[model samples]
Target: MNTWRQTSPTGRALLVTVLLTGLTTFMFLPLLAVHLSSEGVPAGRVGFLVGLLAFCSQGFSLLCGLVVDRFGTRAVLASGFGLRIAGYALLGAGTASATAVAGIAAIGIGGSLLGLAVKTRLVAEDGVPARDMLALRSTFVNIGVIAGPALGALVYPLGFGWILAACILSHLLLAIRLTLRPA
Candidate 1:
């Protein structure tokens, strides 16, 4: 609390944004297989889809690092938010298997981009203490990891579409907040 108070308002806002983004991503993870299985997807294929998402995220993290260096963090972050919005929209639609796969891939890629951009912006660009900021970030990630699944389990009874809609709203709200922030 004291550390956050000592930090600039912008830093606090950025940290909150990072936390929300992390929450949105992880909230859907545990629900994915169950949701797909409910939709009649087989267990084996659901596992493959989960693995695919992990693979895409890892691959895209490497790619995003290079892209962030070239294009700048703001642009990369905006692109990530855009991809997340699109992905969540597709997921909410629940139209076809292919669409779901593409949505998952987009979410994976966007998450990677966001992870890189947020860290770079805070540590490299804003000159925050890396150790402190990282520690704070880790705390937020852990909170999200715990809270998300519980939130998913609670809301999931309503429907997976509702969960996806909540995620879309989260990303969209973050994007709007980002746009409103001063450069």
Candidate 2:
């Protein structure tokens, strides 16, 4: 166990997790509306797709909380990012509604699991002073929420496909960061 007696693993993990969360948020939410719009999906349908992410993520969060202890953070993080990669690929291809929904659900599940793993590991490693870790993580998530939409808007001018590619790069970076640090 990497104790938090000296340099706080919780704080460090929180910082990294925040960045990862930002990347994750950037991966899906920001591009969702734009992606759907580009596909000529009805605005109402776009709204439903966006809403599905939150609903699906809620369920996934519950499941992730249950299994995170056994799976470990590394595995969860890797798998989550992998799902995001697949989700982006499917979205980029403009798959059928059923296929897109399945992919979105996968994204929600993977993202939630990754989040739980990060939180659990930070709590375990940081111990009592986990508040700072939690706060930092929350802040990062908020930042992601703010940045994602703005980033999404840029996709129109640059190219919709570029958004998917960028997300893939972000996920790769996230995986690298988690693997190198092992926390």
How well does each candidate superpose onto the true structure, as a TM-score?
0.93, 0.80
Expressed as tens digits, the lDDT of each residue in 1-183 for candidate 2 is 222333365456555656656755674576678668877888888888888888878877877865766777778877887887777777777757987787777777767877787777666652455665566567778877777767767664777778677777777776677756654
Residue-pair clashes per candidate, as listed?
0, 0
Q: Which candidate leads in TM-score?
A: 1
- After superposition, the stretches of candidate 1 with alpha carbons farther than 4 Å from their true spots are 125-127
In model 1, the clashing pairs are none
lDDT (C-alpha) at residue 163 in model 2:
68
**lDDT of candidate 1 over 74-147, digit per residue (tens):** 78878888888888887777737798788888888988888888887667424457777877878888888888
